[model samples]
Target: MNTKPSSNRRLLAYALVYKYRIIAAILILCCAVVAELGGPYIIKTIIDGHLSLDEGDMTPVLALLGGYLGLLVLAGAANFSQSYLLQSTSLQIIKNMRMDLMRHVQRIPIRYFDNTPIGQIVSRIANDTEAIRDLFMSFMATFIVSILQLAGIYTALFILDYRLALFCLILPPIFVLIMYVHLKYSKGYITIMRARLSDMNATINESIAVMPIVQAFRREKKTLEEFEVLNEDRYVNQVKQFRVFSLSSRNAVGTIGALVTAMVVWYFGGNALDGAIRFGVFYIFIDYLGRIFNPIIGIFDQLTNAQRAFVAADKVFGIMDMEGVEVEDASSAKRPEGAVKFDNVSFGYKDGENVLKGISFEARKGETVALVGHTGSGKSSIMNLLLGFYEPGEGAITIDGRNVANTSKQELRKHMGIVLQDPFLFAGDIKFNVSLYNERISPEQVKQALRDVGASTFVEQLPGGYDEPVVERGSTLSAGQRQLISFARALAFDPAILILDEATASIDSETEGLIQRALKVVSEGRTTFVIAHRLSTIREADQILVLHRGEIVERGNHDTLMALGGRYYKMYQLQKGERVAV
Candidate 1:
C-alpha cells in the first residue's frame, strides 16, 4: 500500500551495494566492543578476586593485568580496522551516488536547467553529497558501534545483578524522550539551514559570473548586501540547530546518566555494606553502568546528520524521479536529409500560454530559410523544436518525413548543428573545440573545418596555433574569434542541417564579411536556417518568414517582402537609415 521509500531506505540501499564490506566492518566493531567491555570486568576480578584475598599471590594478579593489556591492544586493532573499512566503503558509496546524480543531470530535460540555478545544481552535486558522505562515514558507523556496545554492557550488567541493572534501564526511555524532543525542534532548523546554504551558493555563483557587469555598473554594495542576508539567515538557523543538539546529546546524557548512577550505587552500595552482595558483583555493576550512556549519546549526536542526509537524498531522488528522454544506442528512423517542416505547430514554455502559435513552415533540402522577426517573435523557439530540445504541444514536426517526436533526441540532433550569437567555447584548444572529442572527427577534419570557416587566419597566428589552450568560455579569445570557432564547430560535423541563430550579430563587420564568404561555401548542400536580427544579412536568403507576436505576418524572399511594403520592408528600411516609418 506504501509506494514511497522509507526515510533511511535510500541511504541503506546505497550501503547495501557494499554490504560485504559493511558487514565486515560491523563484525569488527562487535569484536572491538567485546574486547573493550571485558577490561572493566577483568579489573573487577583483580580487585575482588585476587587483590582482596589475604593470602595473595601477586602472580595471578600480574597475569590478569597482562590479560587486560592484551584485550586493550585487541580493541585498539579492531577499532582501527573497522574505521578503515567503513571509511573506504563510505567513499565508494558516495562516489557511486555522485556519479548517478551526474548521469541523471545529463538526461534530465533542458527545461529544468532553464528554471533552476546553476549554483544550486552544483550544491546538490558537491555540497549536499559531501554531507551524505558523513551519513555513512560517521553517523551510521557510530550508530552501529554504539548499539553493540550498549547491548553488550547491558547483558553484562544483568548477569552481574538484574536488580541493580533495572535502575539503568530507566536511562533508555528518558534518552528516547529527549531525542523525540530534539527531533521535533531540530528538523525545522536544519531544513532552513540547508535551504539557505543552497541559496548562498546560487548567489555567489551568479555574483562571480556577473562581477564584470556589477563593477561596470557600480553595484558591488548591493550584491554584497544581498549575499549578507542569506549568510546571516544560515548562521542563525545553524546556531539554533546546535542549541537543540547540545540539549539532547551530551548534556542530557550526562545529567540523566549521573542520576541513574547515583540511584544504583545508593541501593546496591548500601546492600554491599550490609553484606547482602559481594564486592565483586558491586564492582562489576559500577563498571557496566559506566558503559551505558555512551551509545545513547552517540545515537542522539548522529540524529542531526541523519536528518540532513534524509533531506538531501530526497532532493536527489526528486531529480531522478522526473521524466527524461531515454537515450537509445541507435535511432529507429533513417538519417534525415534536412527537409524540416513545422506543421501547424504550437508550443509554450508554460501551460496555456503559447509562444509559437500555429506555426506552419517548411525548408526543403539544401535551401536556406531565414526567420526574420523582432525580439520575442519566437524565432529561437522554432529552432528549439527543430532540434528536439522541445516538442510542440499541438502539432507535429517532421524531418525528411520522419516524425521528429518519435525519433530519439540524441539521434535527431546527431546530424544537426547550430551557431549562436554568443558562442560558447569549452576549455580546450581550437582543434578539440571543433572536434568536441568525437573520435569520428579526426585532427585533419578539425583543421579543415576551421580553415573552411575562416578561423584559421587568426588561429594560425597564435603561439600554439590549433593546439592553443582555451580558458573557460574562451574568454582568452576575441568575440569574432569565438564566433568563428563556433561556426567551425558546426562545419566540423558536416551536418545535414545547420542553424545560424543570430550568429553574426555580436561580431565586427570585417569578421562578418569573412563569415558571409564562408557561409556561401558551407550552405551549398545543406538546409540552412538563419534566425537573424540584421535584415541586410538575410537579403540573399532563398526565403524569409517575418513573424510578429506568435504568427507569421509575411513570408517571402527579401525583394518580394520589400515589394509587399509590410513589416519586413519597414524593418529593412529602418535599418538602412531610410525614413520609412510604419
Candidate 2:
C-alpha cells in the first residue's frame, strides 16, 4: 500500500547506466531535425524559382533538389543511429530494474509474502515493469521530437505570416482541454483493466496448478464459467477506455482540420492575403500544420497510457518500500546454544482471538520435543513463531537468553533448519537443488547428505544421477523421494536445531520407516521439534506437549501422558483403535 511515486527525478537516477549512449541518440535526433527542416526549405526554393521561370536560375534549382536528397539520406542514417541507441538504453534499464526489484523482494519480511498474491507479484516483476520500460522507450523520444517539431513549425509560420500563426495558437488550447477530460476520466479505467487482467491471470495460474484436482472432481465447466466472468469484466473496461480515446482523438484532429480549412479560405478571400501568399507556400504551410497537430494529439493520447504506466510503477515501488528484514550482523553470526524457551507467549493472526496463548515451554540444548494436537490447535502456529515467520503479540521467545526480536532473522535462521510437510525443490539438477548453488558445499558432500537420508540409491538409479533434472517443484520425483531430498538438504546444513512439521505424515509405512531411521541419526545430539499426526513417531521424545484451543492442556513424555489419561491419552487411544481396525 505504501507505493512510491514514479518521479521523473527518480527515473533519471538510472542515467548513470545509459547516459553517454542516450547523449549520442540525442545528437542523432538533432541531425535528423536539421535535415527535416532543410529539405522543406529546399522545396520552397525550387517552387519559387520555377514560378519565376528564370532560365539563368535553373542550375540553382537543380542544386537545391540535390541538397534536399542529400539531407534525406543523412536523416535516414541518423534515424538508424537513434533507433539503436534507444533499444540499447531500454534493455539496459530493464536489466537494472529487474535486478533492483529482485533484491528488494528478497529483503521483504515473510509476512508480506503471505499477505500478497502470487499473481500480483508476478505482474509487478514481469508485466508492470515491462509496461514502464515500453512507455519509456516508445514515448520519450517521440515526445521530444514532437516538441521540437511544433516549436520549429510555430517559428516558421510566425516568420512567414504572423496573423495566421496567431490564429493557429487559438485551436490548440481547445484541443488540450478536450484531451485533459479524456485523460482524467480514462486513467482510472486503465488501472481497473490492469487489475482485472491480473485477477484473470491468477485464476489461470491456480487452475493449472490444481488441474489434477479439478479434473478428478469434474469441475472444468465451473472453472470455464468463472474465467468467462473475469474476461467479460476486462472487455467492458477496455471498451470504455477505447471509446474515450476515440472521442478525444476525433475532437482534437477534427477541430484542427476545421480551423485549418477556415484559415485557408479566410486568407485567400482577402486581396491583401491572396496577393502575398503563393499556392506552393500555402500547400507547404498546410502540410506542416497537419504534421504539428498530429503529434500534439498523439502526445495527449500517450499521456493517458503514461498515467497507467505510473500507476503500475507505483505498485512496484510500493513493494520495494516495505520494511526489509533487518540484518543483525554483517559477518555471519555464530550459532547460539540451541536452547529455546517460550515464556508467556501469546499470538494471533489479526489483533484478537489468540491462536497461541500463555504458552510456556523449553527444549533443552540437545532434546526432542513433539507437539501433538487436533487441527487448529496451534501446533503449526507455534512452529511458525519459532521460525520468526510471525512475532508474538505478548511476551517473548529466547534462544540462549537472547530475545528473538533483537536478533536478525538471517542470523537466527542460520542455526536452524526446517523440513515442512511439502519440501520445495526448484527446477534444476538434483545436485543444484540440494546445494542451492552454495559453493561452500561440494559435490561429494551432496552425495553424502543424500546417502544419509537414504536417497542415494534411487538418485543413482535415475538416468543422470545427480545431473538429473528435478523438474518444477520436483514433480518428476515421488512424494517420498521429494521428502528424502528435503531431508538431505536439511542434513547438509548440519543445523543445531531442526523443525519437522508433519514431515512423514504423507508417506507410506515403508517410506516412513526409512525416514524415521534417517531422522534418528540426523536429529541426535541436536535440539529438535516435531509436529506429528502419528502418536507412534514421538514415543521416544524427551517431552510431548498437547495443545487444545491455543492452550497446552497436557504435557509429559509418551508413557507419563498416557498414564495421566488426558488429551494426549485420548489421542493415543484413538490412533491405537484406528490401527487395530486397519
Candidate 3:
C-alpha cells in the first residue's frame, strides 16, 4: 500500500474514534494561542501608544508589563493542558490500534506465516506501531497548532499592512517546492532504512536461536560479517535521509524567512520615516512576521515525521488487509467419532507437484494404524491433512463421515491430539504445561495424566512434583522428561483421536519401555495413528502401511508383511542389523 491519501484516511479514522478528547485538546490549544498572540500586541501598545508619547506615564508602562507577564503564565498553563490531553488521547488510540492488529494477526492463515519472517511481523506490530504513535502524539498535534498559529499571524499582518501580507504569500510556494523535492527523494531512502532494520532483526533472531549450531561449527566470524552488511546498509540509508532533511527542512525555510524579513524592513522602514505608517502597526507587522515564519519552519520539519508515520501506517494496514482463516460457529460444529478416512487423496504444499498422490487410508475407532516411510514419503503430510492444517488437493478426508475440508480447524481439532517428534514445552509449572493452563482440567486430572504417562516417576522426585517450575522450552528438563510431559498433556486433553509422530525416537531405551506400557493404556479405545522410524514401536499395530515415494506399496499386520518379504521385511531386517544385499 502507498503511504498517501488512503493510508492517511485510515490513520485519521483510528484517532477520530476518540473525537471528544481531540476536541477538548483543540479548545485548550486555541486558548493557548490567544494568550501567545496577546504578548506581541501588548508590547506593540506599550512601545507605540504609551512610550512613544513621551508623557512620562510610568503607571501605564508598568501595567502593560504586568499584563505581558500574566499572558505568558496563561499561555504556559494552557499549553500544558493541551499537550497532556493530546498525549493521553494518542496513547489510547495506539492501544486500540495494536489490539486490533494482534487480533487480526491471530486469525490469519498458517500459510501467511510460512512465507513471512517472524521478525518482520514483530516489527510491524511493535516498532511500526510505536512510530505511528509518535506521529499522533507529537507530529499531528504540532502540525495542527503550527497551521493555526500561521493563520493567526497572517491575519494580524494583513490588518497591519495589506502590502506586506501579499508579499508574504510568495514565500509559501517556494517552501512547497523545496518540501516536495525532499519528500520525493527521502521517502524511498526511508523505506530502505526500515526494510534493512527488519532484515537485521530477522538475522539477529535466527542467529541467536541457532547459536549452538554456529558455535559448534565455529562460524562466528561469518555470522558477524553477515550482520555487519545489514547494519551498514541501514546506516547508509540513514545518512541519505539526513542529507535530505538538512537541505530542505528548517534550514531551507529559515533562509527564505530571512530574505522576507529583509524585504519587509526595506519597504516598511522607508514608509515609517515619511510618517505614512503608524509605529504601532509597523511593530505588530514585524512581530507577526517572525511568528508566521517560525511555525512554517516547524511545519516543514514535521514533514519528515509525517512521512515516517505514513510509511508505518501502510505496512500496518498491509497485514490488516490480508484474508484470514474462516472460523465456524461452535453451535454448528459436529463432534467427530475418531474414525478417520482419506479417500484417494492427493496433495502438495505447492502447485503442479503432488506430495501424496491418490493415497487412500482408513483408521476405524479403537484401531491403531501405523505409517512407515522415508522422510519425504508423505507421512507427516497425512497427519497435517487429518488435523485440517491443509486440505487435500483431490478427493476427501473425513472424520465420522463428515468432510474435513468443509470444517473449521477449531472444530476438527477439538477431539484430536498430536505429540510431535520434538516436543515443545512453555515456561511454567509442570502441572500448567501438562494441562496447558486449561481451567476445565482439574488438578486431580493433571496428576492422573502424569501417572498414566509414567511421568510421575520422575516428576514425583522433583521438589514441587506437579508444581515444579519448568524453564523456557523446558530446557532444564531431560529429553525423556519433556517427552513424558507432552504425552501427559495429550492424555489430559483426552482426545478421541490421537497421533504420535516419532514420539519415542529421542527417548532412551528405558524411557521407551515405560512409554510403550503407558501407550497401551492411553490408546485403549481411541483411534490412533503412529509414524515410527523404530519398527519395534509399532509391532502391535492392527495395520501397517509401507509407503515409498508418495504411494503405499504394501499393507498388512507385522507377521503378514514379514511373511511377504517385501519393503517392510527389508526395513525391519536393516534395523535388526541383518545384512540385506542391495
Candidate 4:
C-alpha cells in the first residue's frame, strides 16, 4: 500500500542509472586509499628498521624511499581518474533529471498550474535540481571515499596492533549518532527554509512579470515588502539550520578526533614508558588515527548538503510522479469538417457549482457563431469545452456527430485553433513564432499568413522582416502586432475550428478592420466561434448567442437580436450610445 518511495530508495534508484561509472569510480578510490595508506607504514618501517639504529645499510633505506614514492604516484593517478569519473557521471544524472522534470511539466494538466505558482515550478527545475547535483558530487563522493579510507586505515592499525584497532571500530556508530541528533534538531529548519526559498522565488517572478503594472500603479514598494518577508523567513530558517550544522559537523568530528588521539597516546605512551612499544609502532598508530578522522571530518562536512539534497530530491521526484496526460499523437487520417455541438452540457471548475449550465448549441460547417456575454457568463466556458480544455460536468460535446470525449485531447485539438484576449509571443523571430517551428508550415505559408492577417505592413518595414528578433513575450511589439501574429499563427495552421476570444477588444479601429477583413476570408468552410464584447463586429455572424448567468438568454443573428429588442439589443445600444435599437 506504500505508493511513495522513501528518499533513500529514490536516490539509490537514480544513482543506479550510472551504476557502472559509480562502481568504477569507487573501485579506483579504494585502490588509491590502499596505496596512500601504504606510505605511512613504509615510513614507520624505515624509522624503526634503519633510522633508529646506530648504523644500518644505506641500500635498504634507498630501496624503501623508491617504494614509498611509487605508492604515492599510484595513489595520485588513481585519485585523479576516480575524481574525473565521478564528476562526469554526477553531471549527466542531474542534467537528465532536470530535462525529465521540464518534459513532464508540459504534460501536466492546466488545473495544476492554475493552483501552483509558476515560480515554484521554475525553482524546482533550476534551483532544486542544482542542489541534487551536490548530493551526488560532494555527499556521495565524500561518503564513499571516507568508507574506503576508514577501511584502509583500520587495516593498517590492526597490522600494527589489534587491541587499539578494535577500539577504533566504535567511530562509525558515534558519527551515526551525531548525524541522527543533527537531523532531529535541524530537519524542521531545512524544510521551512526550502519552502521560504520557493515562496520568494515565486513572488519575485510574479512581480517581475507584472512590473509594468506594479510601477504604473506605484506598487513597487509593496511588492518589495512582500518579497522581503519571504526572504527574511528563509534567512531566519537558514541561520537556525546552520546553528545545528555548526555544532554537529566539524566541531563534533574534531572533538571525537581529539578524544581518540588522547586515548591512543595514553595507551601507547604507557607501554612506551614500560619500554614495550617501539617508536615506529607508536608513530604509525597516531598517523593511522589522524588519517581516519580526516576523511570522517570530510564526510561530516557534506551532511548539510546531503540533507538539503534529500528534500530537493522529494520535490524533483514528486513532480515526475504526478500523473500527466498521456501523450497521444493526433490521428492522421483526414481533416475535420468542423461541425461542433454542445448537447445540454453543464460544467464547473469546482464540484456542485456549475459555471456553465445546460448549454446546448450547434454550429454547422462554414458558420460563424458569435458568443456575446458580460463577464463570467460562460461564453469562454463553451469554447473551453469545444477545445478540450476541460470536460463538461454533464452531457457531451461532439464534432461531426461523433462524441469529442471519445478521442484524445491532442486529436481533438489537431483541427482547432484559438486566439485569446491577451495573445502571447515567445522569444524568437517573427516567422518562427508564426509557424512555431512546425516544419509543416513553410516560409511561403508564413509570408502568406502574415499578408492574410495584415501583419506584413509593419513586419516588412522592420530590418529583419519576418526574421526580426523578438524579446521575451514580444514585449517590443505593439498589442495589435502581437494579436495579428497570433492570428497569422492560427491561420497558418489553417484549422477547421477557429475560436477568437475577444480578439479585437484591445486593438485600434484600423487594426480591427484588418482583422475583420481577414475573418471574412478565413471563416469560409470552417466552424468559427467568436467570443466578443464588441457587438458591431459580429453583425454578419451566421448565429449570435447572448449568454447571461451561465445560460443563453437569446440566440439569433445580430439583425434578428436587434429586432427582438432583448438583452442583446440593450447591450449593443449601450456600447454604441444608441438610446434604442436601430
Candidate 5:
C-alpha cells in the first residue's frame, strides 16, 4: 500500500465524521490569519500615511494604536478558538480509532496471535496510536497554519513590492527540495526505529515474564546482554533520525531564509536610499519576509512528527487489515448435543506437513475419552481442532451430527469448557475468577462450583474468601490452587462438553488425588476428553486412544489395551517404571 496516502485518507475519514467542528476550526483559523496579517499592514500605514503626513494631530496616531490593539485581541480570540476546536476534534477521532482497533484485535483468529508477539501488538495499540494522536493535534495543525501564513505573507509582500515578492517565492521550492530529501532518507530510518521499538518492548516483556526462570538458571547476565542489544538497536536508529533532522530542518531552513533576506535587502536598500521606494514599504517587506520564514521553519520541524505518525499509522493499519481466517456460517448456529466426533480429521500448522493424520475419535454424551501420547503425537492438535481453534486439513469434525467447520465459533464454544495444564487467571477476586464475571453465573453457583472442585477449602481460608484479590496471572496462588480455580470456572459455566488438557500434570500427588475425585464428579454427566501424560489417571476412562505419529495406534479401555500389549502397553509400563524394550 501507498502508506502515507492510505494512512492520511483513513485519518481524514475519521476527522470528516465531525465535519462541522472541522469547518468551524477552519473558519476560526482564517480569521486568526487575517487579524495577524493586518498588523504589519497597519504599521506600514502609520509610518507612510500618518507619520510622514507631518500632522500634529495626536488623535490619528492614538486611533491607529487602538486599531492595532483590537486586531491583536481578535487574533488571540480566533487563535484560541481554533486550537480548542481542532484539539477536541482530534481527541474524539483518537477515541473512536482506539476503540475500533481494540475490537478488531479481539476478533482476530488465534493463529495470528500464535505467531505474533503480544508486546508488538500492544505497541501498535498503545504507543503507535499515541503517535497518531500527535499527528492530528500538533503536526497537522502546524502544517496547515504554516501554509496559510506563508500564502498571506506572500500576498502582502506582492502588494508592497512585486519584485521582492517574486524573489521570496524562489526560496520555497528550495525548502521543498530539502524537506523532500530529508523525509525520503529519514523514512527508512523511522521504519527501522519503529520496528526496533517493538522488538525492545517484546524483549522487555519476555524478560520480565521469565525473570524467575532466568534467575533459577543463573542467566540474568545473558538476559541483560540480550536486552542491551535490542535497546542499542533502537537507540542507533533514533540517532540516525536525529542526524537527518538536524541537517535538513530548522537550522538549514534558517540559513536559506537569511540568504533570501540579505538578497532582498541589497535589492531594496539601494532603491529606498535613491528615493525610488517608500521607507515604510521597505520596512513592511522585510517584516513580512521574516514572518514567512518562521512558519516554514515550523513546518519543517513538524514534518519529523508527521513522519513518525505515518510510521505508526502504517503499523496500526497492518493489524487492522487482517481478516480473520475463521468464518462462521449464520445458518449453522445451534446448540450442540455433546456427542463429539472427529472423522478422518487431519491438520497442519504449515502447508504440506500434517500434524494430525486421518485421526478419528468419538466421545458420546456422558462419556470420558482419554487421549494418551508423547509430545508432538498430535494430542493437543486434536483438542485444538475439536475446540474450533483450528480447522482440519481433511475430513470433518461434528457435534451431534452437525459439522463444526460450518458452525460459528461462538456457538460452538458456547456449550464447551476447557481447563489447560497451566490455567490462566485474570487479576480479580476468587469469585470473579471462578465466574469470569459472567452475570448469568450467580454468586451461589460460583461458591457451589468451587466447593465441587474442592477449591473452597483454600479459598475460604484466605482472609477475604471469595473476595480475595488475585494478582496478575494469579501469581500469588500456587499451581494446584490455580488449577482448582480453573476447574471451578469451567464447571460454573455448566458446559455440555468439558476438555481437560493435561490438567493433572503439574499438581502434587495429594492435590491430584483431590482433583481426581473432583474430576469424576464434574465429568459425571458431560462429554469429557482428557489429554493425559500420566497413565494411571486414565485407567477408569470409558475409552483410551493411544496416539503415535499423528495416528491412533491403539484404541480400547485400559484392560483391553494392556492385554493387546501394543504402544499403549509399552507407554503404560514405561510410566510405571517397569522394564520395557524400545
Candidate 6:
C-alpha cells in the first residue's frame, strides 16, 4: 500500500456509523447560533425601546432581560450537547479503527513482518491513532462549529446592515490566503517532526524490549547514551515545531486584530457617528464581529492539526490496506488427509533470490521426516510454508492431493501443530494458555496432554499447579519450562501433523531426554517434521534430508547418511569436537 496522505473519504467512512450523532451536533450548533444571535437583538430592543422611552416601557424591558438570559442559557445547553455528541463519535471511531488494524495485522503474511520494522508497525497502531484522535476531537469538531458560527454571525450581521457584513466577509479571504501559505510551508516541517517522534518511540520500544540482554552484557551506560542521542533529536524537533507554531499564531492574531480594528473604524464608527445605527447597536455589532473572527482564527489553526492527522491516518490505513494472506477458499474443499508434499517448491522474500529452490519432498502418513541445515538454509522457511505462514512462489504444496493454495489457511492449519524455537504464552493462568478457547477439551484431557509432554511434573510442583499465573510472554518461566508448556498445549490440540523447529535446541540434555520421551508419545500415529540443528536430535528419524543453501543435497536413513560421510557426516564430526555428547 502506498503510504501517502489519506484523503477525506477514508475519514468519512469512519464517520458513517456516527452520522446521527453528527447530525445532532449540527442541530445543536443551529440552536447555539440562534441563541448567540438573539443576544444582540435583545440589546438592540432594550436600547431602542426602554432607554429611549419613559417608565411606561419598563415591564417590556424586564421581559427583554428575561429573553436575553434565556438565550444565553440555551446557548450553554446546545454547546454542552454538541461537545458530548462529537466527542462520543470520535472516540468510538478510534476504538473501531484500533480493532480493525489489529485484526488486519493478524491476517497478514509472516514475510511482511520479517521485512517491516516492528517499531513502525507499533507507531501506526499507537502514536498515529492518537494523532487521529486529536484531529477529530480538537480540529474536526471545532472546525465544523466554527463554520456554522461564522455563517450564522455573518447572516445576522447582514440582516442588520449589508455594508458591514460585506466588510466582515472581505477580511476572511485575505486571512485564508495568508493561512494557506503558512500551512504549505509548515506541512513539510510537521511531517519531519512526526517522523522523528515515531523514530524516537520506536528506538525507546526496542531498547526497553531488549533490556534483559543489555543488562546481561552490562551495557546500561552505553544504552543510556544511545537513548540520550535519540532524546536530543526529539527535543530539537519539538523546539523547531514550537518555533513554527509561534510564528503561525502570531501571524493569525496580527491579521485578525488589524481586520477587527479596520471594521470598527470604517463601518461601526461611520454608522454610530451619523446616527444611522445606535450606540448599543454599533457596540453589539463590534462584539459579534470579534466573535465571528474567533472561529475563523480557530479554523486556520486547525489546518496544521488536520495535516498531521491526515498523515497519521494515511499510515494507519496503509497497514489496513495491505494485501493480507489469502483466506478465501470454498467450504466444499475437504479437510486435508495425513500426507504432505512439496512439488518443486521455490520461495523467496524479494525478486530474483530464491531461499528455497526446486525442492521436492514428501511425508507419508505416520512418517517422521527430519530436516538438517545450517542457519538461513531455508529450514524454517519450509516449516513456515507447511504451516501456511507463507505460500510457495513456484510449484505447489499439497496434503493428500489437495493443493494448499486452493484451501483456506484456517482449514489447512486445523490438522497441523507446531512448536517453535521460542514459544509465546499470554498473561493468564496456565490452564487458559493450555485450553486456548477450546472449551471442549476438559481439565482431564488437559492434564493428560501435560502428562504426555512430562510438563505435569513441574506444573504440579507450582503453587497453584495448572492455575498458576503466566506473566507477559511467559517471562516468569524458564526457556525449557516454556517449551514444555508449549508442547503440552500443542498436544492438547491433537493435530494430525506435528512440526518441531529446533524445539529442543534451547533445553539442556537432561530436559531434552524428558522431551524426547514426551515427543515419542506426541509423534505416535502422526506425520512429524523436525528441523534439528543438533544432529543427534533427529538420529532416530525414519528419514533425514540434509539441506545445503536451498536444495536437498542428501537424503537417507541416519545410518546410511553417516556411512556415506557427506556434509551431514562433517557436521556430526564438528559437533563431536564441541563435545556434544550424544
Could you say which candidate leads in lDDT? 4
Writing each residue's lDDT as its tens digit, candidate 4 over 361-477 gives 999999999999999999988888888778789999999998988988888888888998899999989999899998899999999999999999999999999899999888999
Q: Is candidate 3 or candidate 6 better by TM-score?
A: 3
Summarize candidate 3's per-residue lDDT along 375-425 as a digit string, tens digits.
999998889888877778999988888898777778888788899989999
lDDT by residue for model 2 (1-582), tens: 725545455666765568888888887887887787667767876665554546565666677778889999998998888878877787788778878888888888777878777777888888888877866776666676667667778877786677667877876677768777987889888888888877887888889888999999999999999999989988998899888888777665767677776776676536335566765566566666676776686686577667676777777777777778744562458877789999999999878889999999998987999999999999999989988888999989999889998888888888788888998899999999778887777999999999988899999999999999888888888998998899888888878889999998777788788878888898887899999999999999999999999999999899999898777887888888843221
Residues 1-582, candidate 5: write the lDDT tens digits. 544357778888888899999888888888898999898778888878745434576777787788889999999999999889989888888899998899888779789999988889989999999989989898877887888788788888888888888877788889889999999999888889888888878887888888899899999999889888878888998899899999999889888888878988898889987889988899888888889878888888888788899999988988888886444443454546699888998899999999889988888999999999889999999999988888899999999999988777888888899999999999989999988878889999999999988899999999999999999899999999999999999999988999999998888899889888988888888899999999999999999999999999999999999999988999899989999988
| 3 versus 6: better lDDT goes to | 3
**Which pairs of residues have clashing backbones in candidate 4?**
none
Clash totals in order? 0, 1, 0, 0, 0, 0
lDDT of model number 1: 0.88
- lDDT for 278 (candidate 6): 74
Report lDDT per candidate.
0.88, 0.82, 0.87, 0.89, 0.88, 0.83
Worst 10 residues of 3 by lDDT: 326-335
lDDT of 4: 0.89
> Which sections of candidate 6 miss by over 4 Å?
1-6, 50-57, 270-274, 326-335, 577-582
Q: Sorted on TM-score, highest at the top, how do the candidates line up? A: 4, 1, 5, 3, 6, 2
Worst 10 residues of 6 by lDDT: 328-337
Q: Model 3 Cα RMSD, Å?
A: 2.7
Q: Compared with the true structure, what per-residue lDDT tens digits does model 6 show for residues 1-582?
A: 756445578888888878988999999889988998889888886666535556565766787889899999999999999998999889999898888888899889887888776887888889898888888887988888988988888888888777777877777777677777777777776777677777777777777878889899998898788878867876776677666666766576667667677867785698698888777767777778778767876876777788788888878888888888655544454545578899999998787889999989888988889999898898988988888888789999989888988778888887688888899898998888887878667898888988888889999999999999999889989999999889888889888899998999888898899889888877888899999998888899988999989999999989999898788888888887854323
- When 3 and 4 are scored with lDDT, the better candidate is 4
Worst 10 residues of 1 by lDDT: 48-57
Candidate 2 residues lying further than 4 Å off, grouped into runs, are 1-24, 50-58, 250-255, 258-262, 269-274, 278-280, 326-331, 578-582
